[model samples]
Target: MSHEVIRHATMDDLDALAAIEAECFPPAEAASIYSLQSRLSVYPDCFWLLANGDTIISFINGFTTNRPDLTDDMYDDATLHDPQGEWQMIFGVDTDPRFQHQGHASTLMRAVIEDTRKAGRSGLVLTCKNRLIGFYQRFGFIDEGLSSSTHGNVAWHQMRLTFDEA
Candidate 1:
């Protein structure tokens, strides 16, 4: 991981971010370029990217909200972000196909958790498919059972990593 840089996102990253989102998720699940742009403009600090030299290999992004549960509307609405919110909502954790399983995603996740904790947030929340529950669990996230979110029309389980428990 030497020389691999992790930093907050920028408007310049919109193209690369959108491309990675397309490769990492189904069409219905991927964020549109426009939405990505809006989010980047509104809350760039919440987006983190891991780049191996000049190429982005992975990234994690989301917004903050006082709302404890993740809702579908949060996915498309950048204005929903509240910088002072208690909960940091994770919208996506994506790794490039060519770079999967190389610990990039895990590295990014750790960074997100540490940053959120430092920001004085109460906890971090994310909704993931059943297959990913264990992956998130490794970071101290507890499965809160099925999420009410119907994003992408897929069943998701909400997970939380409370700073108090960490």
Candidate 2:
């Protein structure tokens, strides 16, 4: 692939990121432009973009969390700021349909994993649907079993990747 595949998202990436999210997820799972804007403003370090030449093919966005648990409340309430937190909570990951099966998500995910590790943080954490357990395991994320908190009423699997494991 000729895609450069790495970039720190800026305010200008909002539209592309939102578009990817809309295409890859259900309506409720999609992140709004305003929310993406807010996240970029506070935690640009947690947002990453993967580009194919000039077009954005995939991206991952998240925030820093003090607690180990990936809670549903963190999805909305923006005032719960915690930049000094030890854990990174990945909120959304999406790849444009055209780029599916090309390992773009894995490429972007590695960037986030390294970003968290280089920050001296403990590690990165994320939740995905139950069917995706093995998909994350390939990247070294251990299945922590079932998660209690449900987003948009959909059950999600809580998986974690520790820096020590890498």
Candidate 3:
């Protein structure tokens, strides 16, 4: 983690972000370049990236929404973001395969949680495959079971991390 920086994304990060997304997920699950662009343009502040110098290695991105549950449509629709929404919806947590197991993702997740809390959001929501339930749970996310999402034509489990009122 030496010399690595965690910061909000910019449109300049599109290529690196897309490359990581492709490496970390199958085509069916990976977000398209256009979708990434739209998301970046719409809510760049919601994207947190871990970068070593100019090269991005890991990122956690999502939109804020009042809706309590994650659904399929949210994946491709960047316009749905509501800046003052109660919940931060995590759309993806991607790390470069070369950088996996190095704690970069965890580092970014912690930043995201802290930032979201400071923003006065009620909580965070996300959907993950069965294999990742424990990883997110370590961050205090509670598994809400089968999600309504069919985003990649695969089963997803919804998870939520609600912060205590201040």
Candidate 4:
């Protein structure tokens, strides 16, 4: 692992981020370039990118909303983003295939979690497949059984990590 830096996204990263998403997910499950553009424009601060030198290798992008669950509508509509919302809804955790297993995704995820906590969010929410439940649980996200979302036509399980205010 050569010195990697995690930072918030910018419009300049749109192409690289879209390419990574395509590589990490199937067309049906991946976010379209238009969708990515909308998100970046609306909530760039919520998108964390992990870079090795000048190359972006992984990222975690999401939006804040009062809704506790991630719905398919949120993926395409940046209008749903609320900067002061109570929940941070993680839409994707993308890593370049070559960067997998190097903990890049984990590093970005931790950054997002800490950033959200510091922002006074009530919690963080995400939807993942069955195989990823354990992976998310390691981050303290509790599986809330099956999700109602049919995003990408795939079955998803809702996971949440709540933060208690002192």
Q: What is the clash tally of candidate 3?
A: 0
51-148 per-residue lDDT for model 4 (tens digits): 97879999999999998789999999999999999999999999999889988888888888998999988989999999999999999999999999
- What TM-score should be assigned to candidate 4? 0.97
For model 3, how big is the CA root-mean-square deviation?
A: 0.9
Worst lDDT run of 10 residues, candidate 1, spans 157-166
Cα deviation at 77, candidate 3, in Å, is 1.0
- Write down the lDDT of every candidate, Cα atoms only: 0.94, 0.83, 0.94, 0.93
Each model's TM-score? 0.97, 0.92, 0.98, 0.97
Model 4: lowest-lDDT 10 consecutive positions: 1-10
Q: How badly does each model clash, as a count of residue pairs?
A: 0, 0, 0, 0
Clashing residue pairs in candidate 3 (N, C-alpha, C atoms within 3 angstroms): none
- On lDDT, who's better, 2 or 4? 4
Off by over 4 Å in 3: none
In order, what is each prediction's RMSD in angstroms? Answer: 1.4, 1.9, 0.9, 0.9
What's model 3's overall lDDT?
0.94
Task: Write the residue-wise lDDT of candidate 3 on 89-157 in tens digits.
Answer: 999999999989988899999999999999999999999999999999999999999998887789999
Q: How many collisions between residues are there in candidate 2?
A: 0
Candidate 2 residue-wise lDDT, 68-164, digit = tens: 9888887765556588889988888899999899888988888888778888888878899988888889989999987887777788889999887
